[model samples]
Target: MAPRIGVVTFPGTLDDQDAVRAIRLGGGEPVQLWHASADLKGVDAVILPGGFSYGDYLRAGAIAALSPVMTSVRAAAGKGLPVLGICNGFQVLCEARLLPGTLMRNEQQRFKCSVQELVVESIDTVWTCDFAPRQAIRIPAKHGEGNYVADAATLAAIEANNQVVFRYLHNPNGSEHDIAGVTNETGNVVGLMPHPEHAVEGLTGGSTDGLGFLSSVRRFLSVQV
Candidate 1:
């Protein structure tokens, strides 16, 4: 059977459908997971898409991180389950302590949205194995908080372990080290500011480069089984 990928939808989530479409287009079954449900329904992987969950109340992704589904997500993630958190989802990952570093407001202190370029820096991660090292791809980035920061020690550790996955070519968000994405030590979880799901098809008005991210999950799942 094809891999069953779960796409979690919080109350304010806007990109869940796009994530589902990307999964189907990449040869996987899309499973709709909800915020209130703790059950993952046995999905092979999960995706936390971009959006202002819980109205971005009390900080972006702060409320959604405590949702029931995230409890299960955290547990599953500890077991090395593949999870990709995009944009606000990246904020949630940090808030949940799933991934290191915190996303703060953009350097300009304003919401930014545009098609952006990223250079893949780590190909060993579960969410990035499909891309070659230093390969560049264009994706959409829309967020008020996407700059990544961590303590000096933590940042050094992350760099030492090659946990940084993608870096913005032009540093649109002022992320540390030009970081656009990162992976956990196990490489099973990844978080990025770019909305790969939104860039799956040119008909939607941007490069179809994001399809590789979804396809990469399929390859990762196949290897796991």
Candidate 2:
């Protein structure tokens, strides 16, 4: 069977469908999961797509992080489930304490919409297994609060553990260390401020670089099996 990957839909999430399509294109079964549902439906992996969940009220993904489904997500993630959080989803992961670091507003105080260049800093995570270290890729990035910040201790820990997964090539939001993405210490949970789902197709996103992210998890699951 194809690896079933779940894409979560929160109240104001706008990118869930896109993530589903990307998962299908990457050779995984796409499962639509509602934010209110507690069961993950036996999905091998889960994706939290980009968008202003809960209308971005109370600080981006703060409210969405408390939804019913997230409770299950946290428990499953602790047991080694692979979870990928993109864009505003990154905020939710941080707020839920699944990952370290807080996503702040852009240093320029503006919403940015652009094709962003990023280098894969590490392939140790399940979500990035298909990528090579230091590999350059381009993907669509649209967000107002994509800048990543962390306390000095947290920064040092992630750096020491090679948890930094991706780094911005041009520093679009002035994130510390040019960090665009990170993974948990176990490498099963990952959060990034770019829309890999949007970049899975060349016709729409002008690049297919993001396919690797989805495919990597499928391959990871197969290897485990």
Candidate 1: tens digits of C-alpha lDDT, residues 1-225: 789999999989999998998998888999999999999999999999989999998988999999999999999999988999999889999899999999998999999999889999999988888988899999999988999999999889999999999999898878899999888899999999999988878888469889888778888888674
* Cα lDDT listed for each candidate: 0.91, 0.93
Number of the top lDDT candidate: 2
**Candidate 1 lDDT score at position 94:** 89
Best by TM-score: 2
lDDT of each residue in 129-209, candidate 2, tens digit only:
999889999988999999999999999999999999999999989899999999999999999998999988888889999
lDDT, candidate 1, residue 69? 98
How close to the true structure is residue 59 of candidate 2, measured as C-alpha lDDT? 93
Cα deviation in Å at residue 125, candidate 1?
A: 0.7
**Clash count, candidate 2:** 0
lDDT agreement of model 1 with the native: 0.91
Model 1: weakest 10-residue lDDT segment is 216-225
Q: Ten consecutive residues with minimal summed lDDT in candidate 2? A: 216-225
